[model samples]
Target: MRRRIHAFSAVLALLFVAVFWISTVVSELFLSAAAVAQVKLAIAYALLGFVPVMMLTGASGFALGGKGRHPLLLAKRRRMSFIVANGLFVLAPAAVFLSIRAQAGSFDSVFYSVQALELAAGAANLGLIGLNIRDGIRLGRRRI
Candidate 1:
Protein backbone atom coordinates (compact mmCIF):
# COMPACT_ATOMS: atom_id res chain seq x y z
CA MET A 1 0.00 0.00 0.00
CA ARG A 2 2.82 2.39 0.84
CA ARG A 3 4.60 1.54 -2.38
CA ARG A 4 1.40 2.03 -4.34
CA ILE A 5 0.92 5.46 -2.86
CA HIS A 6 4.50 6.37 -3.64
CA ALA A 7 4.27 5.20 -7.22
CA PHE A 8 0.88 6.78 -7.85
CA SER A 9 1.81 10.12 -6.37
CA ALA A 10 5.11 10.23 -8.21
CA VAL A 11 3.52 9.57 -11.57
CA LEU A 12 0.68 11.97 -10.91
CA ALA A 13 3.15 14.69 -10.02
CA LEU A 14 5.09 14.00 -13.19
CA LEU A 15 1.93 14.31 -15.25
CA PHE A 16 1.14 17.63 -13.63
CA VAL A 17 4.56 19.04 -14.38
CA ALA A 18 4.45 17.83 -17.94
CA VAL A 19 1.08 19.48 -18.51
CA PHE A 20 2.27 22.73 -16.95
CA TRP A 21 5.39 22.80 -19.09
CA ILE A 22 3.63 21.90 -22.31
CA SER A 23 0.81 24.33 -21.71
CA THR A 24 3.37 27.09 -21.19
CA VAL A 25 5.13 26.24 -24.42
CA VAL A 26 2.04 25.92 -26.52
CA SER A 27 0.40 29.00 -25.08
CA GLU A 28 3.44 31.17 -25.67
CA LEU A 29 3.85 30.03 -29.24
CA PHE A 30 0.29 30.20 -30.43
CA LEU A 31 -2.09 31.74 -27.97
CA SER A 32 -3.00 35.40 -27.79
CA ALA A 33 -1.94 37.47 -24.79
CA ALA A 34 -5.35 36.97 -23.25
CA ALA A 35 -5.09 33.24 -23.77
CA VAL A 36 -1.58 33.13 -22.42
CA ALA A 37 -2.70 35.11 -19.44
CA GLN A 38 -5.47 32.64 -18.85
CA VAL A 39 -2.98 29.81 -19.08
CA LYS A 40 -0.76 31.50 -16.51
CA LEU A 41 -3.69 32.03 -14.21
CA ALA A 42 -4.80 28.48 -14.67
CA ILE A 43 -1.36 27.10 -13.92
CA ALA A 44 -1.10 29.21 -10.80
CA TYR A 45 -4.42 28.01 -9.51
CA ALA A 46 -3.58 24.48 -10.53
CA LEU A 47 -0.78 24.48 -7.99
CA LEU A 48 -3.35 23.80 -5.32
CA GLY A 49 -3.53 20.30 -6.72
CA PHE A 50 0.05 19.96 -7.95
CA VAL A 51 1.70 21.07 -4.73
CA PRO A 52 -0.01 18.63 -2.42
CA VAL A 53 0.48 15.73 -4.79
CA MET A 54 4.13 16.61 -5.12
CA MET A 55 4.48 16.85 -1.38
CA LEU A 56 2.80 13.48 -1.10
CA THR A 57 5.19 12.09 -3.68
CA GLY A 58 8.14 13.25 -1.63
CA ALA A 59 6.69 12.20 1.70
CA SER A 60 5.61 8.75 0.60
CA GLY A 61 8.81 8.19 -1.34
CA PHE A 62 10.95 9.04 1.67
CA ALA A 63 8.74 7.00 3.94
CA LEU A 64 9.07 3.96 1.73
CA GLY A 65 12.78 4.39 1.09
CA GLY A 66 13.33 4.88 4.84
CA LYS A 67 16.97 6.00 5.00
CA GLY A 68 18.29 3.25 2.81
CA ARG A 69 21.91 3.57 1.72
CA HIS A 70 21.60 1.48 -1.43
CA PRO A 71 22.78 3.46 -4.44
CA LEU A 72 19.41 3.39 -6.22
CA LEU A 73 17.57 4.54 -3.13
CA LEU A 74 20.20 7.17 -2.51
CA ALA A 75 19.83 8.48 -6.05
CA LYS A 76 16.03 8.64 -5.75
CA ARG A 77 16.26 10.47 -2.46
CA ARG A 78 18.75 12.98 -3.86
CA ARG A 79 16.56 13.67 -6.88
CA MET A 80 13.49 13.98 -4.63
CA SER A 81 15.24 16.56 -2.42
CA PHE A 82 15.93 18.70 -5.43
CA ILE A 83 12.42 18.15 -6.75
CA VAL A 84 10.74 19.25 -3.54
CA ALA A 85 13.04 22.22 -3.10
CA ASN A 86 12.69 23.35 -6.68
CA GLY A 87 8.92 23.05 -6.54
CA LEU A 88 8.65 25.11 -3.39
CA PHE A 89 11.30 27.71 -4.11
CA VAL A 90 11.18 28.16 -7.86
CA LEU A 91 8.04 26.88 -9.50
CA ALA A 92 5.35 27.91 -7.04
CA PRO A 93 6.43 31.53 -6.67
CA ALA A 94 7.08 31.89 -10.36
CA ALA A 95 3.62 30.57 -11.13
CA VAL A 96 2.00 33.08 -8.83
CA PHE A 97 4.13 35.95 -10.05
CA LEU A 98 3.49 35.14 -13.67
CA SER A 99 -0.20 34.78 -13.04
CA ILE A 100 -0.49 38.20 -11.39
CA ARG A 101 1.56 39.91 -14.02
CA ALA A 102 -0.28 38.26 -16.84
CA GLN A 103 -3.58 39.06 -15.21
CA ALA A 104 -2.66 42.70 -15.44
CA GLY A 105 -1.53 42.32 -19.03
CA SER A 106 1.99 43.15 -17.97
CA PHE A 107 3.88 40.87 -20.32
CA ASP A 108 7.11 42.76 -19.91
CA SER A 109 10.71 41.65 -20.05
CA VAL A 110 10.60 40.56 -16.44
CA PHE A 111 7.55 38.46 -17.06
CA TYR A 112 9.09 36.72 -20.07
CA SER A 113 12.37 36.25 -18.20
CA VAL A 114 10.59 34.64 -15.31
CA GLN A 115 8.57 32.62 -17.72
CA ALA A 116 11.72 31.29 -19.28
CA LEU A 117 13.17 30.42 -15.91
CA GLU A 118 9.96 28.76 -14.83
CA LEU A 119 9.83 26.73 -17.99
CA ALA A 120 13.41 25.62 -17.57
CA ALA A 121 12.90 24.73 -13.94
CA GLY A 122 9.78 22.81 -14.83
CA ALA A 123 11.67 20.85 -17.46
CA ALA A 124 14.44 20.01 -15.02
CA ASN A 125 11.97 18.77 -12.42
CA LEU A 126 10.24 16.73 -15.06
CA GLY A 127 13.47 14.96 -15.95
CA LEU A 128 14.51 14.41 -12.36
CA ILE A 129 11.14 12.95 -11.44
CA GLY A 130 11.31 10.74 -14.49
CA LEU A 131 14.67 9.38 -13.43
CA ASN A 132 13.28 8.76 -9.97
CA ILE A 133 10.49 6.74 -11.55
CA ARG A 134 12.97 4.68 -13.53
CA ASP A 135 15.08 3.98 -10.46
CA GLY A 136 11.94 3.03 -8.62
CA ILE A 137 11.11 0.47 -11.26
CA ARG A 138 14.57 -1.04 -10.94
CA LEU A 139 14.25 -1.15 -7.19
CA GLY A 140 10.86 -2.83 -7.45
CA ARG A 141 12.27 -5.54 -9.69
CA ARG A 142 14.74 -6.39 -6.96
CA ARG A 143 11.86 -6.42 -4.44
CA ILE A 144 13.89 -4.31 -2.05
Candidate 2:
Protein backbone atom coordinates (compact mmCIF):
# COMPACT_ATOMS: atom_id res chain seq x y z
CA MET A 1 0.00 0.00 0.00
CA ARG A 2 2.78 2.39 0.88
CA ARG A 3 4.63 1.50 -2.27
CA ARG A 4 1.54 2.12 -4.33
CA ILE A 5 1.06 5.49 -2.75
CA HIS A 6 4.69 6.36 -3.40
CA ALA A 7 4.37 5.38 -7.00
CA PHE A 8 1.26 7.53 -7.34
CA SER A 9 3.07 10.43 -5.75
CA ALA A 10 5.96 10.05 -8.17
CA VAL A 11 3.63 10.12 -11.14
CA LEU A 12 1.83 13.17 -9.77
CA ALA A 13 5.14 14.94 -9.27
CA LEU A 14 6.09 14.24 -12.84
CA LEU A 15 2.77 15.50 -14.11
CA PHE A 16 3.13 18.67 -12.10
CA VAL A 17 6.59 19.23 -13.53
CA ALA A 18 5.41 18.65 -17.05
CA VAL A 19 2.58 21.14 -16.63
CA PHE A 20 4.96 23.78 -15.38
CA TRP A 21 7.39 23.02 -18.14
CA ILE A 22 4.75 23.43 -20.78
CA SER A 23 3.53 26.63 -19.19
CA THR A 24 7.08 27.97 -19.10
CA VAL A 25 7.70 27.18 -22.73
CA VAL A 26 4.44 28.72 -23.79
CA SER A 27 4.99 31.85 -21.74
CA GLU A 28 8.60 32.20 -22.88
CA LEU A 29 8.09 31.47 -26.53
CA PHE A 30 4.71 32.88 -27.40
CA LEU A 31 3.41 36.10 -26.03
CA SER A 32 0.11 35.92 -27.86
CA ALA A 33 -3.35 35.82 -26.34
CA ALA A 34 -4.03 32.18 -27.08
CA ALA A 35 -0.70 31.03 -25.74
CA VAL A 36 -1.26 33.05 -22.61
CA ALA A 37 -4.62 31.38 -22.07
CA GLN A 38 -3.06 27.98 -22.55
CA VAL A 39 -0.41 28.77 -19.99
CA LYS A 40 -3.06 29.93 -17.59
CA LEU A 41 -4.93 26.68 -17.97
CA ALA A 42 -1.74 24.76 -17.42
CA ILE A 43 -1.03 26.65 -14.22
CA ALA A 44 -4.55 26.00 -12.97
CA TYR A 45 -4.15 22.32 -13.73
CA ALA A 46 -0.84 22.24 -11.94
CA LEU A 47 -2.47 23.64 -8.84
CA LEU A 48 -5.29 21.09 -9.06
CA GLY A 49 -2.69 18.36 -9.40
CA PHE A 50 -1.21 19.30 -6.04
CA VAL A 51 -4.21 18.09 -4.03
CA PRO A 52 -3.63 14.36 -4.48
CA VAL A 53 0.13 14.71 -4.34
CA MET A 54 -0.07 16.49 -1.02
CA MET A 55 -2.36 13.79 0.32
CA LEU A 56 -0.02 11.05 -0.80
CA THR A 57 2.99 12.73 0.77
CA GLY A 58 1.20 13.42 3.99
CA ALA A 59 -0.06 9.84 4.14
CA SER A 60 3.39 8.55 3.35
CA GLY A 61 4.85 10.64 6.15
CA PHE A 62 2.35 9.39 8.70
CA ALA A 63 2.71 5.80 7.55
CA LEU A 64 6.48 5.91 7.74
CA GLY A 65 7.67 7.96 10.74
CA GLY A 66 4.93 9.79 12.58
CA LYS A 67 4.76 6.98 15.08
CA GLY A 68 5.74 8.56 18.36
CA ARG A 69 5.72 12.31 17.78
CA HIS A 70 2.92 14.70 18.67
CA PRO A 71 0.97 14.76 15.44
CA LEU A 72 -0.58 18.16 16.00
CA LEU A 73 2.75 19.82 16.64
CA LEU A 74 4.42 18.23 13.68
CA ALA A 75 1.47 18.99 11.47
CA LYS A 76 1.53 22.59 12.60
CA ARG A 77 5.14 22.95 11.59
CA ARG A 78 4.59 21.26 8.27
CA ARG A 79 1.55 23.42 7.49
CA MET A 80 3.37 26.61 8.35
CA SER A 81 6.23 25.69 6.12
CA PHE A 82 3.89 24.77 3.30
CA ILE A 83 2.08 28.09 3.62
CA VAL A 84 5.31 30.04 3.65
CA ALA A 85 6.73 28.20 0.66
CA ASN A 86 3.51 28.53 -1.28
CA GLY A 87 3.46 32.24 -0.66
CA LEU A 88 7.07 32.56 -1.70
CA PHE A 89 6.67 30.45 -4.78
CA VAL A 90 3.12 30.59 -6.18
CA LEU A 91 1.74 33.87 -4.84
CA ALA A 92 4.87 35.91 -5.49
CA PRO A 93 5.25 34.69 -9.04
CA ALA A 94 1.57 35.18 -9.77
CA ALA A 95 1.69 38.75 -8.56
CA VAL A 96 4.69 39.56 -10.69
CA PHE A 97 3.18 37.96 -13.75
CA LEU A 98 -0.14 39.72 -13.23
CA SER A 99 1.56 43.07 -12.90
CA ILE A 100 3.58 42.52 -16.04
CA ARG A 101 0.58 41.26 -17.96
CA ALA A 102 -1.48 44.22 -16.83
CA GLN A 103 1.15 46.68 -17.97
CA ALA A 104 1.12 45.06 -21.38
CA GLY A 105 -2.65 45.68 -21.83
CA SER A 106 -3.45 42.05 -22.51
CA PHE A 107 -6.82 40.75 -21.34
CA ASP A 108 -5.50 37.23 -21.40
CA SER A 109 -2.87 38.27 -18.90
CA VAL A 110 -5.60 39.02 -16.40
CA PHE A 111 -7.01 35.53 -16.90
CA TYR A 112 -3.55 34.09 -16.58
CA SER A 113 -3.05 35.86 -13.30
CA VAL A 114 -6.40 34.60 -12.12
CA GLN A 115 -5.33 31.07 -12.89
CA ALA A 116 -2.09 31.51 -11.00
CA LEU A 117 -4.06 32.81 -8.07
CA GLU A 118 -6.15 29.66 -8.20
CA LEU A 119 -2.98 27.62 -7.97
CA ALA A 120 -1.90 29.46 -4.87
CA ALA A 121 -5.31 29.02 -3.30
CA GLY A 122 -5.33 25.35 -4.16
CA ALA A 123 -1.94 24.83 -2.55
CA ALA A 124 -3.16 26.45 0.64
CA ASN A 125 -6.21 24.22 0.63
CA LEU A 126 -4.04 21.17 0.15
CA GLY A 127 -1.88 22.20 3.08
CA LEU A 128 -4.90 22.48 5.30
CA ILE A 129 -6.13 19.08 4.20
CA GLY A 130 -2.77 17.62 5.11
CA LEU A 131 -3.05 19.14 8.54
CA ASN A 132 -6.47 17.59 8.95
CA ILE A 133 -5.17 14.21 7.96
CA ARG A 134 -2.32 14.44 10.41
CA ASP A 135 -4.63 15.42 13.19
CA GLY A 136 -6.93 12.53 12.39
CA ILE A 137 -4.06 10.10 12.44
CA ARG A 138 -2.93 11.38 15.79
CA LEU A 139 -6.43 11.20 17.20
CA GLY A 140 -6.78 7.65 16.02
CA ARG A 141 -3.68 6.56 17.92
CA ARG A 142 -4.55 8.34 21.15
CA ARG A 143 -5.21 6.24 24.25
CA ILE A 144 -8.10 8.39 25.42
Candidate 3:
Protein backbone atom coordinates (compact mmCIF):
# COMPACT_ATOMS: atom_id res chain seq x y z
CA MET A 1 0.00 0.00 0.00
CA ARG A 2 2.82 2.37 0.87
CA ARG A 3 4.59 1.52 -2.33
CA ARG A 4 1.41 2.10 -4.23
CA ILE A 5 0.99 5.48 -2.62
CA HIS A 6 4.58 6.38 -3.38
CA ALA A 7 4.17 5.26 -6.97
CA PHE A 8 1.05 7.33 -7.25
CA SER A 9 2.84 10.37 -5.94
CA ALA A 10 5.72 9.88 -8.36
CA VAL A 11 3.33 9.49 -11.26
CA LEU A 12 1.57 12.68 -10.30
CA ALA A 13 4.83 14.56 -9.99
CA LEU A 14 6.01 13.34 -13.36
CA LEU A 15 2.71 14.25 -14.93
CA PHE A 16 2.87 17.73 -13.54
CA VAL A 17 6.39 18.23 -14.82
CA ALA A 18 5.50 16.83 -18.22
CA VAL A 19 2.47 19.06 -18.55
CA PHE A 20 4.39 22.15 -17.49
CA TRP A 21 7.24 21.53 -19.87
CA ILE A 22 4.96 20.68 -22.79
CA SER A 23 2.71 23.63 -22.17
CA THR A 24 5.65 25.95 -21.91
CA VAL A 25 7.19 24.67 -25.12
CA VAL A 26 3.93 24.86 -27.03
CA SER A 27 3.11 28.29 -25.64
CA GLU A 28 6.54 29.56 -26.52
CA LEU A 29 6.04 28.45 -30.09
CA PHE A 30 2.54 29.84 -30.50
CA LEU A 31 1.89 32.49 -27.89
CA SER A 32 2.72 36.17 -28.15
CA ALA A 33 5.88 37.40 -26.44
CA ALA A 34 3.91 38.89 -23.56
CA ALA A 35 1.94 35.68 -23.07
CA VAL A 36 5.03 33.56 -23.12
CA ALA A 37 6.64 35.82 -20.57
CA GLN A 38 3.62 35.53 -18.34
CA VAL A 39 3.65 31.77 -18.62
CA LYS A 40 7.31 31.68 -17.74
CA LEU A 41 6.71 33.74 -14.65
CA ALA A 42 3.89 31.48 -13.58
CA ILE A 43 6.02 28.37 -14.08
CA ALA A 44 8.86 29.88 -12.08
CA TYR A 45 6.50 30.69 -9.23
CA ALA A 46 4.90 27.25 -9.35
CA LEU A 47 8.25 25.47 -9.22
CA LEU A 48 9.24 27.48 -6.18
CA GLY A 49 6.01 26.58 -4.43
CA PHE A 50 6.10 22.85 -5.29
CA VAL A 51 9.05 22.06 -3.03
CA PRO A 52 7.31 22.70 0.28
CA VAL A 53 4.18 20.88 -0.83
CA MET A 54 6.02 17.65 -1.68
CA MET A 55 7.89 17.93 1.58
CA LEU A 56 4.64 18.09 3.47
CA THR A 57 3.24 15.07 1.71
CA GLY A 58 6.41 13.08 2.34
CA ALA A 59 6.49 14.01 6.00
CA SER A 60 2.88 13.07 6.41
CA GLY A 61 3.43 9.75 4.72
CA PHE A 62 6.27 8.96 7.07
CA ALA A 63 4.23 9.90 10.09
CA LEU A 64 1.47 7.61 9.00
CA GLY A 65 3.85 4.64 8.55
CA GLY A 66 4.38 2.67 5.35
CA LYS A 67 5.56 -0.53 3.70
CA GLY A 68 9.02 0.72 2.84
CA ARG A 69 12.06 0.63 5.07
CA HIS A 70 11.72 2.50 8.30
CA PRO A 71 8.93 4.91 7.43
CA LEU A 72 11.00 7.91 8.37
CA LEU A 73 13.90 6.77 6.25
CA LEU A 74 11.67 6.10 3.29
CA ALA A 75 10.10 9.49 3.62
CA LYS A 76 13.52 11.13 3.82
CA ARG A 77 14.60 9.36 0.65
CA ARG A 78 11.49 10.43 -1.18
CA ARG A 79 11.79 14.00 0.00
CA MET A 80 15.45 14.19 -0.94
CA SER A 81 14.86 12.75 -4.39
CA PHE A 82 11.93 15.06 -4.92
CA ILE A 83 13.91 18.12 -3.93
CA VAL A 84 16.95 17.22 -6.01
CA ALA A 85 14.88 16.36 -9.06
CA ASN A 86 12.80 19.51 -8.70
CA GLY A 87 15.87 21.70 -8.40
CA LEU A 88 17.45 20.12 -11.44
CA PHE A 89 14.41 19.67 -13.63
CA VAL A 90 12.34 22.74 -12.88
CA LEU A 91 14.46 25.44 -11.26
CA ALA A 92 17.31 25.34 -13.79
CA PRO A 93 15.09 25.96 -16.79
CA ALA A 94 13.11 28.55 -14.90
CA ALA A 95 16.30 30.44 -14.10
CA VAL A 96 17.36 30.36 -17.73
CA PHE A 97 13.97 31.65 -18.78
CA LEU A 98 14.20 34.44 -16.26
CA SER A 99 17.62 35.46 -17.52
CA ILE A 100 16.43 35.46 -21.10
CA ARG A 101 13.30 37.36 -20.18
CA ALA A 102 15.44 40.10 -18.65
CA GLN A 103 15.86 41.56 -22.15
CA ALA A 104 19.63 42.32 -21.88
CA GLY A 105 19.30 46.00 -21.10
CA SER A 106 19.77 48.37 -18.17
CA PHE A 107 17.95 45.86 -15.99
CA ASP A 108 20.27 43.07 -17.09
CA SER A 109 22.35 43.39 -13.95
CA VAL A 110 19.30 43.06 -11.76
CA PHE A 111 18.07 40.14 -13.80
CA TYR A 112 21.40 38.38 -13.46
CA SER A 113 21.24 38.90 -9.73
CA VAL A 114 17.77 37.42 -9.61
CA GLN A 115 18.82 34.45 -11.71
CA ALA A 116 21.87 33.90 -9.51
CA LEU A 117 19.68 33.99 -6.43
CA GLU A 118 17.30 31.44 -7.88
CA LEU A 119 20.12 29.04 -8.73
CA ALA A 120 21.69 29.60 -5.34
CA ALA A 121 18.42 28.85 -3.60
CA GLY A 122 17.91 25.69 -5.63
CA ALA A 123 21.48 24.56 -5.00
CA ALA A 124 21.11 25.15 -1.30
CA ASN A 125 17.99 23.05 -1.20
CA LEU A 126 19.67 20.33 -3.23
CA GLY A 127 22.68 20.37 -0.95
CA LEU A 128 20.56 20.05 2.15
CA ILE A 129 18.63 17.23 0.59
CA GLY A 130 21.88 15.48 -0.28
CA LEU A 131 23.01 15.72 3.31
CA ASN A 132 19.70 14.33 4.47
CA ILE A 133 20.12 11.41 2.08
CA ARG A 134 23.57 10.69 3.44
CA ASP A 135 22.37 10.78 7.00
CA GLY A 136 19.29 8.79 6.22
CA ILE A 137 21.35 6.11 4.52
CA ARG A 138 23.70 5.94 7.49
CA LEU A 139 20.84 5.55 9.91
CA GLY A 140 19.05 3.10 7.69
CA ARG A 141 22.10 0.91 7.51
CA ARG A 142 22.42 0.94 11.30
CA ARG A 143 18.99 -0.62 11.48
CA ILE A 144 19.93 -3.42 9.09
Task: Give model 2's clash tally.
Answer: 0
Candidate 1 structure quality by residue, lDDT tens digits, 50-120: 98998898888888878788899999888888988899899999999999999999999999999999999
Better of 1 and 3 by lDDT: 1
Query: What's every prediction's RMSD, in angstroms?
Result: 0.7, 8.8, 8.0
Which parts of model 3 are misplaced by more than 4 Å?
A: 56-144
Q: Estimate the lDDT of model 3.
A: 0.55
Best by lDDT: 1
Q: For model 3, which pairs clash? A: none
Q: Where is model 3 poorest over a 10-residue stretch in terms of lDDT?
A: 99-108
Q: TM-score for each prediction?
A: 0.98, 0.45, 0.45
Per-model tally of clashing residue pairs: 0, 0, 0
Global local distance difference test of model 1 = 0.93
- Residue 31, model 2, lDDT: 78
Error of 1 at 128 (Å): 0.1
Task: State, as a TM-score between 0 and 1, how close model 2 is to the true structure.
Answer: 0.45
State the lDDT of candidate 3 residue by residue for 23-93, as single tens digits.
56565579765665665566666766555545554664464344557655665666666665666675656
